[model samples]
Target: PAGRFGAKTGGRAGSKPGRPGAAPGARSGGQGGRPKPPGAKAFGRERFGQDLGPVRAPKPKRAGRPADEIDVHNPEGVRLQKIMALAGVASRRVCEEMILDGRVEVDGNIVTELGVRVDPEQVAIHVDGIRLQLNEHLKYYVFNKPRGVVSTMEDPEGRRCISDFLKNKDKSERLFHVGRLDAETEGLLLLTNDGELTNRLTHPSYEVPKTYLVQVRGPMAQGVGAQMKEGIELEDGLAQVDSFKLVDSTPGHILVEVVLHSGRNRVVRRLFDAVGHPVERLVRTQVGPIRIGDQRQGSIRVLGRQEVGHLLASVGL
Candidate 1:
């Protein structure tokens, strides 16, 4: 009698019942006739009448990496913000904000995620479109070298040298002068622990332009700037300045700005000497993108990130 009644009710024999003509083994509610397992976790929204808390929007998907960009992901590498902070880009917090603001890029892909990791040595990183120098060991400085100071790090003759101005710096890291200025010449001299950058900056083939403020005796000269630009013959060979302009002229002395890409020994002095205007005082004001500005003589200042970036970019680094 029970089996025949089950067929009339559309339920399996001995099944619990409420609805007549319901499908066999189907539950009255939406539980599909199966009980939840013991100790099973329940989601908040799944429990009816519970508060769902604040709803969060999904994050936008990142764009695909360019075809030219290599994969920079490194599971064991340091975090992106940590690397940026270590590279002197900014504090870790600020770097995180910069990353979120889309101002940072790794291997040409704009990285906005703070959790991204990168190998500092293998990846190319840029912040605000400026290449970042990631090597912590490398140091760059602009030294306002004083007159009579030898360009060498140490002078054997006991004269003032570049090292004398850097007594407070870490003695372990050897800093090399990018280029030399004779004992009599002075101005902005680059000091760096990066050997590759030093070589590139000093190598004559790179043609990194240097600007100098030259004081020379000038009374009668009509075409001196043009003559120097045209090319002046010296002892070694013909030398020329990229541009020459007279800045100021007094009774017996004149201040001239000379820009040239030559790294020849005393090239500026020799060029002025060839034209009968011996250099009274020679001070290099600029080297590539770095400048002396108002930096006092015999003092050193570390190069800023943007300055270092421009300096490296100038040499195709």
Candidate 2:
């Protein structure tokens, strides 16, 4: 009756030399042991040749050290708020609001704490259950926009949109115009996903240099270039050109290259027009280290890494 330890069915009901079923109040050989934990299996259930069948449940979620708790593993990591901002999903100021609203999470757990440092690329970050892809390729573009299309991302007036050009081109990432060009104006426009760089360059206090070609309707007085370089008083205040040169001059028409660091609302046109020579056409030719560079109208080109670095350095970024 006590012959076999673990005997299969189709055998004698009592314990025997070849087979034996468990006696009442007795346990199977390994049945009394702990139940198989999640994600523990042997070879899994094999199906067809190619189909390996379902996988075991994943191991329990890992609980790592806090992001901003100063762990040696995350030396270069920053707070989650800063990390999210760096990813270009939103600005730091806006991210703080989202965090407080309980819309932000780390590793699928709601993280309401501020000053949490996170390595954006490595950390599992989510906003309202949508996992964010943080390491997407950063893109920088210089567009030579022609007249007619609206400078903004979209226009409610149903006018042609410049963003349409990038609609199908970039799907995973978002691009924003670094600085806006007026609907009538045409020329170089910097585009990028780096919010910090964009905000810095666009801020008036940075005083990044920009150049434009202005076409006046009538001939100017003698020493007009000097007059522009010295500055002209507008209704707002005095405005000066960093440099002005006569590209061409003739009766009823004149072309001049004007450079300035302080950009205002159509200041170039207003300044020339203030001098009794209202500009008939104005095209911005350059900004910081970027130039129009033979880029045709409505064309987008990715700026080279070296060019991006040069521009950043020029602005002391």
> Against the true structure, whose lDDT is highest?
1
Pairs with backbone N, CA or C atoms under 3 Å apart (clashes), candidate 2: 78-117, 78-118, 79-116, 79-117, 80-116
TM-score of every model? Answer: 0.71, 0.57
lDDT of 2 by residue, 115-175 (tens): 5666766666776555555555667788888887777777898887777767576534677
> What are the per-model numbers of colliding residue pairs?
0, 5
Cα lDDT tens digits, model 1, 239-302, are 9999988899899888999899999999998998888988889999999988899999888888
**Alpha-carbon deviation at 106 in model 2, angstroms:** 29
Any residue pairs clashing in model 1, and if so which?
none
- lDDT of prediction 1: 0.80
Single out the weakest 10-residue window by summed lDDT for candidate 2: 42-51
| RMSD of candidates 1 onward, in order | 14.6, 17.4
